[model samples]
Target: MTNDMRRDFANREELATYLKEQFPEAAERDDHISPIIGGRQAAVAALQKVDPVKYAKSRNFLTGAVTRLSPYIRYGVLGLREARDFAFSKIRNQDEAAKFVNELGWRDYWQRLYMKLGDGIWKDQEEYKTGYSASEYATELPQDIREGTTGLVCIDSFSRDLREIGYLHNHMRMWLAAYIVHWRRIRWQEGTKWFLEHLLDGDPASNNMSWQWVASTFSHKPYFFNRENLERYTEGVYCKKCPLYGKCDFEGSYEKLEAKLFPKGEFVQKDNSQSWQKGKRKR
Candidate 1:
């Protein structure tokens, strides 16, 4: 609670123990610490492994070759330009680094919007396109969701990973946000708060804007996913073992899900096809 708080610790474990002792309430909620190390050395080491070519190809999948450098970037241990420059160093040309660079550009865009919008970023940029009034959405996140006991295997797993590891695959983040806002009809701000509380890379601008994007308050349309799309990207790892495999909420085509989740909204069809699908053309 004081500026004179201890800064010296023998190791990460000691530091964690000290933090838990100082902040018992936080520990009670979840004592878990992320395995991702911090500091410039770790950031540089992570940056050294940047494979823009492979990242462009597999970044959407659950087990993709992601750089996992967001925490470093978020905390300023590594700079965005530094990461981009390093990625460029490994690539043959602009096309090879386009996807990776594009992602970095998105982060920059979000931050710029955050600076421009100020506190306005917390408010909806536009009325939600989901055809529901703001009053229709629940303001509080459900207890089951916060506890990671939703019983839907994929969702529960995502919730658990978020609470325990303080990170999620970008796809999982989108799916979870969509589920909370569109599927469960909870307000996106509630989900946004939860993500900020836990994500190691939780940049308020990026996190808030992303939830708004899913909620249709900051995008042309709301984003949702079907089981087939989820399974294809995640290699069916969660669906294959889920007790609700065939009967789960996500078990349907994009058209079917669209009708169900946003019944009152003008339906805009989103591509359900996986980006990594071989032999299938991008729509």
Candidate 2:
């Protein structure tokens, strides 16, 4: 509200009050994730600990050694160029660094796309790029998902982590988004709202586009992941604890998925062509 409020913090908890004043709803719904200590000095402290080499190898897994520099980067506490320089300064191996640097480029891509599209980001960039029509998807996320009572242990746990901590592993995000958009037929916007509310690093540009990416509004096909894929990457942690072990929602192959999820048409085959054409026409 004031210059002193924005710039001054006697204690780190002041960051929470400042954030509440700025985004009252988000701060209230996602109160568990602590307010990060503000300023460039704190940002640099987080940056100094980045290990780009290890990040490259294990970035896809839930337990990966990825740098959690997103909150800093999203809020402008850490600049991309400075992070790149720091990575290169610490690690001599260029190939290993490439994996991490490429992700930064992704951040740039989202920001540029947001600048270009503006509010259009919230609108469908394209039609249902998957097998179904835009009419088929639900406009809002289901109450169970918002309440974290989805019955599917893995998804429910992911929901709790996102709401409570305001951070999720990149892989967890993709998996959860894929399940919601493809398997449940919920519109990406529904998922986008929940993600934006909870994610500490929730950039409107990156977050919305990513939900679009999962929902196939901005990509070739809807991303799908089955139980096997989940267990493989997730180290069987959630599955082992899940109540619905074998007969859960995600048990099947591509063909089975089509029949079970979308019985009318095969989205993976060719229906997406019309959607692409429609988007092109609008452009």
Candidate 3:
């Protein structure tokens, strides 16, 4: 073959077929490709649909009004300022867009931190505060979890979505991370690698830092959630049909969960309502 290569295709399927033929090994490894389109046009279309007010009110839920612009921003097909300006144009007041803007601010913060930390972000920033030593955590991710057959409906769904769709709601991301680290006692780095492999918007900085946050290496305490908290945010969609409902690992009060998950750690727990009031204090 010469330096010149084919760049034109009649459709996405033709493109996918050509790619698979050229990179058969990659296709063998994991052939699933995301349905989310690329390029500036697709990015602008996604940006035009941003609903900041609805996002602020419902971003925590599974079917909320999330602006699916992360992949575009991550790849520079869309710029952060462009997204912010467009969101601001849609909102009537500053408060209406505060939460959405705050999310963008976090992306900026993670990028800056990545620049400073370099490769150091992959290592633990601090000691794990879960009362157990680093040696106690498992180094390998379990096959069941990776295959989305762990039998917990919520977790399995998230795992499948991560692998197949290359996307997940932020709340679901948190819950899944918590399950891997706290419940299964796996090292955060393992989960980090799994996410980076599948997420289209996965940036090492944001992904690693967030994993460390849940692992308690970058945060004050290990983040976790009770059944009630999960059900409330997910609207009980997973729990209602979950075969292990009421008997699963997540079924308990926050206080009970804290004591069980981190018996030797110093993570404090108050009543659910009071503790979860500020930030991730409840977890």
Candidate 4:
């Protein structure tokens, strides 16, 4: 079974004693650098240095404004509460501090949902009934999506960014997920697994749950994005650079794609069996 829950170390004193015995090398090292310590320190420093003003203004820029702390959280290097407290302690006002806190809450929610649902959350209900096949599709779609060869410029750029840095902007993740599910008709579980394999911040709870959320499996109504939303949110930054700006079928709009997938009031729900099939295929 994949362990997706976070663990607490009981107390700092006990944790220190255990680390001394279990990790002698780490204990002796003066710098004491690990995912948790490094992540907490990095978060604290970012909070102290940037605080409300910088984070508020530049968090969405996608270049370098946001704190890259997901790997630490994913690996249990840093506890969620510790990170939250550190940020709250640094910020003077509650309202401004809430922005960062809400982001952390999202992490907590993903984990909670995973614990509550377990593997059932990953299956697709429509596959068996509709005779939706995944094996042949999985072999091809993952390569095309990961290689950025799907002919979708924004998605390709996001894929390339993830391959190079194991990171993508928050907005880019949603856009990529939507395109992969609705436009490409690839299984979200397949896409989610591919991400976990490559992403430095591959937390099962967050990664899987977020993919389901985007695919609309968690909700009755599937969340779809269009060209206008992209243009407004991305500030038309992707318009000129995207390879599929006008030539491709989607044309960077989800309305047409949605109509095609769910014609005659038929909703395109995610198939959870895709997750298990993917696991078997990987083995």
Candidate 5:
């Protein structure tokens, strides 16, 4: 039999040095980033504290009571079935618990699709469903957005949150995706790659297709929101300090936004009455 092989670090400094050398991208994060406790015990502790009743009501808000169990689930330290059991045990009310369970279901849904598609998950599964061709979008994220210097205060803060902490609110993820895909006119693939690099919970399956959903590639319509929508959710924290203010990139309702951005007037309307069937069938 062959001898077992092993390597050991002399100290934390040596470990840090080795990690930096081998994985230059895994740099240190800000102190304010949410503290994570790994292992089964910590996952159990975190799960026990989840309030499904409150989560269903305020989960969309920035300060919402979300069960921060994503990293554990992503790493295999926790399993979906166990998490679901804990949720159900806490709240027998199916309606309130259903919302939380459904959110977890999305993770399973993404993984199943990922296995079915294999490598095809990385490539575009359909044409840009927004009535625009693939040729119209940028292949790479813009330098400004990558550098977190877009000058839109809220977006920049979100950018810093992503890169620094490797975490983001789900709504913020959609908001940024909508901005890049619809407003900046970048390809969803570009956004996906960028997000994958930083998101601690980033799974290629859910991440990429969700980006497509914002692009209307996987959904019936392109997802968009005006500044007012941002203000309502974030409680005007970023907008108040923002120079873009009311005149920031997203300025109008869907109709006006469509006229301003996709002036070709070929995009499907909100009601899904008009068919954008030119692309691959929506999954």
Candidate 6:
């Protein structure tokens, strides 16, 4: 699939030539691609009105922060460098531009990590066992979670949004990860796989790394969410109407889990205990 020239060509000249011949002027005039491109132009026009400050404050708030550029990015319709440069050009303020730039950096970082680690990053880490199991839960569990049936108000709402629109707020992504890892006791890898399968903008590195970060496998501290945090963040949009609001038992604790994975405030050791124990046994 990666080698499919129709999707991703190394040179624009080749792509342009192909587009020109395959879609002559008369055909191009009547084709749907023109309208789709026109729509993107319209969206860009709207975004240009907001500029930097609006994007910085609202980007993480489950609203209009997203660029909706994923389909173009994924299909090679918009090249990565093109998006980066355009963002930088428009949002000239250092801090405002930095927010968008950092997100792009995350994309690059994930790609590099995937290339460097390959399948190893997906392997089970013994360190993840605390407060959660790495096993795939019953299919019903995922279905319930995805379908917003888990009863956790915030998670259910986000899950429903994802199912209906294939999108979730940035904060909601973290919330969902915490719920799946801490509340559901499911493996981050499983959650990552699920998102990759369903998300319209899913990229392996971002999905895996984000899951690991929430699972507390990649960072020194495990991310946890409490009802108060949810209420505050979501502006009381959740909890009141949740199916599991009163009945669920998970408390969203991370102190012990963080200590186990990230002792003495250090990043989690990359599970080298096997080699250490084997060497000691040999002695």
- List, residue by residue over 239-258, the lDDT tens digit for candidate 2: 99898999999887756776
Candidate 6 to native Cα RMSD, angstroms:
11.2
TM-score of each: 0.93, 0.84, 0.93, 0.67, 0.85, 0.66
Name the runs in model 4 displaced over 4 angstroms: 1-64, 124-142, 252-257, 266-283
Estimate every model's Cα lDDT from 0 to 1: 0.84, 0.76, 0.86, 0.60, 0.75, 0.58
lDDT of 4 by residue, 112-152 (tens): 76788788657752342112344423423567787788666
lDDT of 4 at 160: 77
- Off-target runs (Cα >4 Å) in candidate 6 are 1-50, 124-126, 129-142, 243-283
Candidate 1: segments with Cα more than 4 A from true spot = 1-3, 272-283
Evaluate model 3: give its TM-score: 0.93
**Sorted on lDDT, highest at the top, how do the candidates line up?**
3, 1, 2, 5, 4, 6
- Which pairs clash inside model 3? none
List, residue by residue over 115-185, the lDDT tens digit for candidate 5: 99898877766666566788899898997887679999988898888887788887788888888988899
lDDT of 2 at 122: 95
Tell me how far the alpha carbon of residue 283 in candidate 6 is from the true structure, in angstroms, after superposition: 38
User: For candidate 3, which ten residues in a row score worst on lDDT?
Assistant: 272-281
Reference-based TM-score, model 6: 0.66
What candidate 2 gets wrong by more than 4 Å, as runs, is 1-30, 35-39, 264-283
* Model 4: lDDT of residue 40: 59
Cα-lDDT of candidate 1? 0.84
Top lDDT prediction, candidate number: 3
Clash pairs of candidate 5? none
Task: Find the candidate with the highest TM-score and give its number.
Answer: 1
- Encode model 6's per-residue lDDT on 189-229: one tens digit a residue: 77877777556667776777777766656654456655655
